[model samples]
Target chain A: MIIDINAFLGHYPFRRLPHNSARTMIELMDAHGIDSAVVSSLHSVFYRDAHRGNEDLFLETKDFGSRFVRVATVNPKYVSWRRDLDEAMDRWKMKAVTLFPAHHGYLLSDVECQQAIEEIVRRDIPLVLTQRLEDRRQRHHWDAAEDLEFKSVLELVRQHTKLRLALVNWIGLDGKRMAEAGLQGRCLIDFARLHVLLNKDVDKLISSLGITSIAFGTHMPFDYVGPSLVKLANLESNPAIDYPAVSWRNAARFFGLEGGD
Target chain B: MRKIDVHNHVFDAVDQPGANWARVESMIEAAEWLGIETLCCSRPITGGAMAEIAEVRRANDAVLATMQRYPDRVRGFCFIQPGNGRLAIDEMQRCFDQGMIGVKLYNQFKYADPMVYPIAEKCIELRIPLLGHSAHLTDARSIAAQPMTSDSLEFCKLATRFPELILILGHINGGGDWEWAIKGLRECENVYLDTSGSVLENDTIEMCVRELGVKRILFATDQTMEGCVGKILSAQLSSEQREDIFWKNAHAIFARRTS
Candidate 1:
């Protein structure tokens, strides 16, 4: 079963963009052979902080049952961080948390930020950090979302050695230099953009980094499902290496769902 | 799904950069996924006078290498760098001798850029088709920054001089920049619209197919920066229109091989 780790659930800035409803999103996922997804809300990333998005996520996941896994998005800079996170954890039963450092404008190395990360790690929930959602070249609505500060992320990972950080939107070209600099296995990465790299090249990266380091992600509403599905189907390599593990097995293990198989 | 990708690139093994090889392999994998057949041109051919003859030769060799690496999946064009008419003629002759199919020109430079005219004339003389980039230079903002407008007009003039030569105005889908080129080529029987480039919302193909016939529209994917075959399939065209645009017309143009 494929699990999309990069999926989103809330109304984004796309007030005019044609998109699938929650029900249609499930249908499209099924159409593309994706069985389950771990989703967050863009609204949570934008306004009312992660607390509000987490509330909406709980509501949305209710209809999908186990098909939709909830990830609470929190603003490290928010004043009510501890209270909001405690409520999200005790009430909503969230398994993971996503951080929007760029949107929230908080450095990963901020002392207060480290406290928040510590709280999330203390709860044994995986932390997902989204880099950027759209291509910078595309016409944008505003200047808020820009290129992510990779150095800050690297530093954060180095400081919190035991934290299970999920870097969503991993790519073949961009993060390779860091991987060479000893950043390979510590963070769990989503494979939404890896579709751009296929065949023997994909095999090389997989052999070097175990399947557990990967996570399948759809980057829904922004990216079309066809390209990602087409690439995954045609990926060339040893069957075991190219098999669906990054998004499915990795998330399953991280979320304590051994019965996902 | 028999399909033709109008835009692509290849480089010589000896001269090709490592990153470029990786990019090409990735692109080939992408093409295989969509069951596409692609026509690859050399960087020298696409980049025009900016390329040297030796570099063009290496690029030609690279295109030959890519064709060899993926047999039956790739076709090629004899790229002519600007200002080298003698070399362009020599390259055209070599292409024919080496079994290359057509010609490609980046028509974004000065229309009458002295170096380009000879190649245009040579293409006409050789009876080979040339795919030209056409964007409008309505003002200076896009002109100095882009390589699209005036060159298309020059290409049209050459096409008028040689009626038998097949000239395709590429990226008709490129908004405003090439709108005039599209309008100008509508009256030219020998000139066709190669539907390729950017993810534009405006429906250029519909207008081309309506004003000109389906026979005049050729499907192309600028695969380096875009998805080659998937883009062709993604177009908001009818199945019949897509079928003709994607395969039939291209097959008819490069008719020698069994692609």
Candidate 2:
């Protein structure tokens, strides 16, 4: 069974997604052999108060049961974010929380963000940070959502060594640098945007940074899932590497959902 | 269907590690995994950016060597810096004489620059396609690093000036206004948009097929084979159209080369 760590539901304001609804998303996943997915709401990216978006995501995935895990969004820019996060964890039972620093106009170093990270760590819930939602070149002509500063995120991760942070949509030199900066076991990287792994460097990356911290994530609806699947297939062909660990085991262990299925 | 990747780089750069013969072999394995039959490889622009004319020649020679090694699986494109002027033209001839299939113009000079005309004319004379790197950004600050970056409009202008030259405007999906870039090349019959670049947005390939028919679009991975295949598969095109973009068009275009 495959567990996709980065999937989204709801409309993307920039371009129309082929499968934006939960039903279509599930159908898409099933067609692609995805057993379960940790999904967030695209609405939360643009919303001023991300709580409403989180509530929408909760309602969307509530009926899907374990097949679809809800990942709530909390914008530290809002003053009542801590309450929203608590409600998401306690009431909605969200297993993860995602942060859009670029869209929400804040840095990972912000005090509110730090407090939220601490709260999430205290609750043992994973924190997923989307480094970028859309490709910088493809952003709307007027949309000014810059990429989240990698230095700031690295600094934050350094401070919170035990924090379970999953950096999503980061690839190439930056991703490699982050991994090389002693983030191998400390932080997890979503494979949805690691295009370089599709090349000959897959084995090199695996050797340098073991497969434990890498997780399967297909930024579905925003990005096609086929590429990640291709990367997984390539990894599976190699007998030396543990493809299952990256496919689902790592994510399963990270979310503490191991042995449930 | 058979596939020919028209925009693949095969070189080890100073900054990007693991770019060696073993790496290219792994890339070829990955491409073969997806049923790609041939990769028309060229040295990456980053490799030629800091090198002297002799180094550039050595880089092209390395590409030729890889082609010779792979024979059926790999084809070499002579990468030239138009700024080298007469020496660039001579190097193109030298590589062509040594079995290089086509010309790959990097971002050393704009597609619209007069310096590129001689190279375009050389490609036309050699009956080879010129694969020029094209992006859509107009912001001076963004392109300050690679000042020679050309947009599709510049390609259109270049095509108009050299009607006989077959200009393959590469990387339509490389983080620029691709819609405008694709549309700008609508009337230029000799210009083809390659499906390369890193970002593969939904409907991008289909949109390119819609604006410029499948005959004018060539499948390319830019050395990112898996992602490129995903982009092509995600496109809502029929089997015939897929075949055309995947290999037929590339075969038809590159077949005319004297080499």
Candidate 3:
């Protein structure tokens, strides 16, 4: 199945998002032949109260059912995170949790983050970390969100043993650092930002970082799905890459979808 | 419908040991999904912060070789550094003689700088477009690195100076403020923006169409092939408008050679 591991719903402040609604998003996915998308709310990344965005995310995708793998955006800094996260997982069926440490103003090292990480680990749910959801350089003038640093992820991997960390957007660029951080099995990455055809980064990365580490993502609605599809086209040509693995198998495993791995 | 990629690059992969049509074919094959019919390719100087005249010549030579090798598919864009002064103009002439369709400028000099005027004049005289490497950088550090980087603002400035110049501000989504870049480009009828670069902001292509009209926008990848192709494909443009941006506009620029 073609799955977009990183997708979103909700209005982006900078640009008019035509495909933000569930029906429009599905139409876009069908137009692109994407079978499923792991979706969270875009406002969740910036909202002061994480549950507010999660509530919106659940509301948006509730009609589509499992066609959208609802991922709750959790701010460990928020006091009622534990209860809200449980409600999102149990009540809303948000199968995965995404953390915007850079946006929410907490490092993976923070005490609250560690607590949330432990709880997520206990539940055996994947914790996805998004970096630079919007290109920081192109962010709206007043938006102060910074790109999540690579080292912060390294620290997360180094510290949390069972954390199934899924890195998204440009954060997944440095395969070398990821290889160094030992981010193969437990950690997964989306390929929206990885350059395959133009630069040899993806080829070199797959050789070293292993093919299973990468999965399909387009940063859709917020961005276009075209680039990831292009990257996928290039990857499919490489005999070394297992097309199915990057296409959907690894993503299924990462996001706890059926038929994964 | 034919799609022309007006801004793309060829690395030294062709010069690598035992390099064959396979490398070029792979690029074309990769773009088969997007059906990229023609690629206007250039190899800008890779090693240095600024390119010298010799380096500029070598880059153009690389472009010439690609164009020759894939004559039907590849169109050469002569990459030059205006700082090379007389030699740069001469190099542009040499590439034009070799059938290069346009001039590709890196951050070696600003588009509005006096040094670039001679090259702009050369492009105008030859009826070839001058595609400037551009970005509207906001941060201080990035600005520090590519200080000579031209943007749509500078392209407009240059177009104002040379009204007939077919000036292309390369990669609106390349980086920095695209809203700023696209807005700045509206008044300069002579300046066109290529759809390339990595960032595929939703409505960016539509915004360009809204502001600049379909005739002036060019389809380009700048090596970020999929993103750009995707941007245009997913845009709120009709098939005819898509064809116009993807092929006709580039066809016009490449066909405009006088001598």
Candidate 4:
């Protein structure tokens, strides 16, 4: 079984996402042979009341059963974030909590963010962070959100030794840096944005971070599902790598699901 | 079905030099893994800035050697800097006659510049496609190090001047407002958009196919092999449309465009 560690539901502010609904998402998953996907609210990224997008995501994925796993985005900068995070956990049963620190106008190093991670860690849920949802260079003129700086991310990973952080749509990071920064197994990076062939970054990443730290993800609605699937294909073809860990095992374990190694 | 990657680079032996021969081998290994049959490759010398004519020729010679090494797998595109005036055309023709299939232009000069006209005309005379690098950006163009880079609007200008020129716009999805690029580039019936690079975004191929149609799109990776191919598969395209973009259109670019 394949689980997409990263996927999104809700309307993108700029440009049209033809497959923005849960129905289209399921269709895409079926097309790519992905059994499940951990989905978050794209609307939460733009909405000032971030929980409103969580509500939207809840209404959409609530009836879908286990095929869709909800990932709630909590903005620590927002005043109601403390109450919202608890509400998301208790009511929405959010399996994971994602933070768009860059878009939320805060740093991963912030006290507010640190507190949030503390809360997430205590609850035993993985904290989802992303380098970017969109390629900054290709962003719409209005999308001025800066990418997550590596130093801030490194800072957080070092501080929270037990925090399980799934980094989605990340680029340019290799295994060596992860080892040096002591960010290896604690952080799980998805392949939605990693170049499997061009840079052969996956080869470098697996060598340093080990297969367990890598997971499958597709930044859908904003991006295609096929890149990660094809990446899995490439991984399977490589005799040295364990394809199942990247394909679903790591993601399943990271999300606290069944079917993990 | 076979695939033709119309635009990618040869990064071995200067360009960055033989320091990266392993990289060249890895690119071939990737192409083979992905089922890519032909790689229309070049060695872009300007590196991201303007280059002298001699420097440009040296880079093209790298492509010549790469093409010779791969032979059937690798095809060459003689890279040129339009600012070099007649010398640019001389190098372009020299490489073409010596088996380079097309011309590759970077961001040193915009597409609409007078210097580009002669090169475009040279492409017309040789019946070869001209692959011009572009990025559709607005306020923060300087950050990308492509100050004078051509956008879709400039490509439109050049296409209007030389209707017969087989102008393949490099990497519509390379980076920057692709929706803007698609809408802005709609009128240039002759400018074929190579769906490459930022195929990261879903529906890019569908939007491109919708705006530019099947016959005007070509498949390329600009180094992002899986993303580029995946972009086409993600699009709602017919078999015929896919075939056209994959090879037929790019194949036609090399055949006599005097039609």
Candidate 5:
């Protein structure tokens, strides 16, 4: 039950990588033993229309069976956001939504935005928020993050009470601090971009978070899967916590795939 | 036999640029074939201005995924842009609180840049080592291209500024920088070097062996994208030095840092 928790489809304008079809990505995932992936669309975020990417990603995941779950990147701030969400679920059949606050340019705490988040939570669809992409020093756009106020994101999550967030792009240091701050119980952090420090810390992190707050991810189509999976496969975690169940089971439960085989 | 890797990187696989899952898998398959106990990968480090915080955070998301993927075999470093002190600290606290052991800095940015002082000070106060690039004998031309020596000096300055912090200078070979680094960094007891990159000049290793002793040196591969076998075997110091550099020194540092 290996799950690649973090993934994107379509063309990303910032990175000059060729876009691979979802079928090709699935083949690649199969080769790496990734049983499932939570996918978003790169083109949608770039164009400020997650629907385009969400439509393609939804069609792609439906064909992949349970191996791929459609996690559409949504921008609630859009006036047509209600139609967008309905179409994404009804038309695309997606079970999750990934919101890019910085790229989408709407504070999570916005009144309308908070209402939308509540609606998504009411639907029981997982909401994954992509925090940031690059270190501030290395951003392709110098001022891309200047207007980003993460407090709004955190506060929104706290306010929702029932909102369970799947945070992507959480680095080593920040992820740990979030765990220490007790964000893990309510928010699951997908380790899609972590690399540094000691291997033992992985077990420690999982243990600290009680496994339920953890999920496996590989930022695929940008980087390869070998190192991504190897980081986990190489750890010497206790056998009980080191199983695929810990990797995929918790994620399956979080995303409402509890009965998934 | 707990092994620690202080540097690494992970990118989004869904929108891959260079190699895909197969490429990275085979590479790791090869590493596993060679018996590397563990390796830590970082969120991808893209070179650019400090204003690219969002991009950095995106890269960091991938890093978080990697750490969660292999909790036993790998750990992750929070690659930070020193320009946003407040945000960077928030990220450091976030990742560190999540159980990350330290932070990483690329030489593309300076160690002594005024923007970075706050970050260094925080790491020192928190007792997390800032793993960064450094060279001993640097070529001025390559220095312009990479700025290894200047960054190394600034690393020393960082140690001087925050005496309790541990600054691990990555890569002790492929140039004469390690040789010169010993002189500049020796006075700062908190400063240490990780034996990585190309093989060190035996004389340089010997000098470090006698002067700084093995305790000041550590064994690292800097081989995130490369094979780790060669780098692991590259620690050509004596068995005693090997003990300290390969495992003991890291354990000591980890113990203190973790506490």
Candidate 6:
């Protein structure tokens, strides 16, 4: 069973996405053997107030039940973001929250951002940070999602030792740093951007970092599921690594799901 | 099904001293896992910056040596630094003599530059395809970098000048407006789009197949075989269309030098 920690719903304003609807998302997950996914809304990305998109996401995935778990977004740039976070937690029953600091034009070091993260920790919910929505080289000409500085994210992770964090869409050397920093076991990383294929780099990562801190995340709707699955499948062949842990066990455990499916 | 990867790099890391050879080995293993039959390998243009003619020769020689080591699995492309006019031509001749099949031009100079015309003429005379690094220019930052980079429009201009030369627009998915890139090169039949680079946007492969026929798209990984092949496999295309992009088109394009 595959549990995708990073998936999205709603339309990406710049390009055409194949599985933007809830139905198509489920179809894609089923086709790719993804049992469950933590989904955020792309509407949250473009809309000025992410609370509206969060509400839309909650309404959209509420019907699918356990197959799709809602991961609401809160743009801390808003003055009333704390109230929105409360509604997302208590009213929406979102399993986790996603921060688009870059898109929202705020630093992770901002007081509001730190307070929101502290609250997320207080609630005992996981916080997923999407480092980038699109490849830096291929961002849309008019408006592109700026990336959150890696050093800033590292600083946030170091300060909030009690917070459960997972970073998504980081690639190459940045991914290596995330894995190294995740040694604390409080933070985890999604394999979608790592592109760890069958190689010594992944092997070393599994051996040194431990497989429990790694989770499968497909940046779907914007990206394809095939590469993430292929990476997982390739890593599964090594006897030293645990495929179940990376694929679903770690995510299920982190999100407090029962039995890891 | 057989597959040919047109855009692949073979270089040892100068920054990370000990990691070079292992990286190359891992790349080959990854290619084998993806079932790629032949990889057109060249020394990455970005590596070592290719600032001097000697560096260019060293990079091409490295590719030649790699091709020799794995004759059946690998094909070499002589990377040229057009700024080194006469030396670049001599290196191209040397590479051809050493059984290199094609010429690889990177961001050293724009494809439309007068310095590149001689290289294009040589490729035509040698009956070899010229693989060029091309992307869509977005802003002033990219415009300033244009002396070393070529967008699809530049490639279109180059193709118009040399209609007989087979030009490949490498990484049509890399940056800028891909729709503009595709439309800009739509009239240039000699120019082909390489499906590589880091951007695997949904329906991009389908868009390429729709705009440019299946034969015009070449499946390439740009060193990340799994990621690249995954993009092709996930593309919503018919089996025949997949075959054409995966192997048939590449085979036809590369078969020219032999013919």
Task: Note the Cα lDDT for every prediction shown.
Answer: 0.64, 0.80, 0.82, 0.84, 0.63, 0.81
TM-score of chain A of 1: 0.87
Interface RMSD of 3: 2.4
Off by over 4 Å in 3: A171-182, A200-212, A233-245, A258-261, B13-34, B46-51
lDDT by residue for model 5 (B216-246), tens: 8776666542223223333235666555665
Fnat of every candidate, listed in order: 0.06, 0.35, 0.55, 0.61, 0.00, 0.49
Highest-scoring model, TM-score: 4
Model 6 per-residue lDDT tens digits across residues A1-261: 889988899988777788988989999888879999888999998899999999889888889988888887988778798889889888888888988887888778988888888888899888988877876555566665566667887787778777887777665434456555654466667877676754444555555556777888888988888878888877787677788888888898888787855
- Model 3 CAPRI rating: medium
Best by lDDT: 4
User: Candidate 2, which segments miss by more than 4 Å at Cα?
Assistant: A172-187, A195-210, A258-261, B13-20, B44-55, B138-141
How many clashes does each candidate structure show, in the order listed?
12, 0, 0, 4, 90, 0
| Candidate No. with top DockQ | 4
**What lDDT tens digits, residue by residue, belong to model 3 across residues B1-259?**
6899988887764643476655566677656756898988888874336766776777677677777778888888888888888988889889988898898888877778898899989988898988888888877666777778888888988999999999889988888888899999889998899999888877888889999999999999887776787678778789999999989988887766753
For residue A52, model 6's alpha carbon misses the true position, in angstroms, by: 0.5
lDDT of 3 by residue, A1-261 (tens): 688888889987767777998999999898888999998888887678979999998888888866799998889898888899989999988888888877788777889989898999899999887787777666666677678888788888777777788877863466777777777677777878776765566676676678777889988887878778867876787787899998999888777788974
lDDT of 1 by residue, B1-259 (tens): 6778765666435335553577567667767756676654544444324666776677677777676667677777877666564876797778767766777766535544656667667666665677766665444434445554443566567667767677777666553344455567666777777766543322345567777788888877665223234334444468888889988887787763323
**Runs in model 4 lying further than 4 Å from the true structure:** B14-20, B139-144, B257-259
Q: What lDDT does candidate 3 reach at residue A134?
A: 71
What are the TM-scores, per candidate, against the unseen true structure? 0.73, 0.89, 0.90, 0.96, 0.53, 0.93
Candidate 5 lDDT for residue B78: 74
Residue A185: error of model 6 in Å? Answer: 2.3
TM-score of candidate 6 to 2 decimals: 0.93
The interface root mean square deviation of candidate 4 comes to 1.8
